[model samples]
Target: MSAHGETPHGAQGGHGNLNQLMAGFALAALLTIVPFALVMGEVEINRTALIATIMGLGGLQILVHLIWFLHVNRSAEEGWTLAATIFAVLILVIVLAGSLWVMKNMNENMMPMHDMEHHMQMEQMKSLQSQQG
Candidate 1:
């Protein structure tokens, strides 16, 4: 027996990282294919439902990448990896939401061309009246 009460690099044991990786890849591929087919094929899914399904699949794909590609498990580094990942995701969401909100507000509050033109015309009328007085 070796450290952690497991044989050293033994087959058919110790979480089967390769098998898990293959499963994760297969799941990710399936998620990708489903959405692609929904978009490209003749399926008549509702637009809102389709979008929601796509987003859900994308989130699952992210989880698969995290667990399989990055090897972020519960025991790894005392779960610091998971914690860091959550923190990073939180930061990303905050930044993206804040940016979008600012852009939307800017677009909503901006003066239109007609409003500017009206203001300019009013100013011209006031200048002419002052000059005439």
Candidate 2:
């Protein structure tokens, strides 16, 4: 028998660990409400700053789930787990930032003043020709 009145290799330790992990998951879930509520509220926030904050908070929440629910930090595969996390985060940043860059450029370049003026002139010429005909 071990110190807690169960065999050393008994399931008690595993159960306790599971319970603690469950508690951590519960806390994480509760914490998720904060971000959601903040988003749903109609308060004005800076667009870029708000996006960054939400992304950072989501990344933190993912880390919490990995550490607590998946036991990634304490597992024998900890190194691989950390590497995967880093890779995932890098990919996420690249995707989000790259998409934003592309979208911003598209918005800027989609309608040049020269093209607008040319279209307006064509419409005016067409109207003049129709009136003369």
Q: Give Cα distance to truth, residue 64, candidate 1, Å.
A: 1.0
What are the per-residue Cα lDDT tens digits for candidate 2 across 53-107?
Answer: 7777777787777667665653454688777877887898899889989998998
Best by TM-score: 2
Q: Which residue pairs does candidate 2 place in steric collision?
A: none
What is candidate 2's TM-score against the reference? 0.62
Per-residue lDDT tens digits for candidate 1, residues 1-133, read 7766667644433445777878988998998999999999958989768867877787788788887677666764448888998888788668766876798799899998999999999999999999999
Question: Candidate 1 lDDT (Cα, whole model)?
Answer: 0.79
After TM-score superposition, what is the CA distance of residue 77 in candidate 1 from its true location, in Å? 2.1
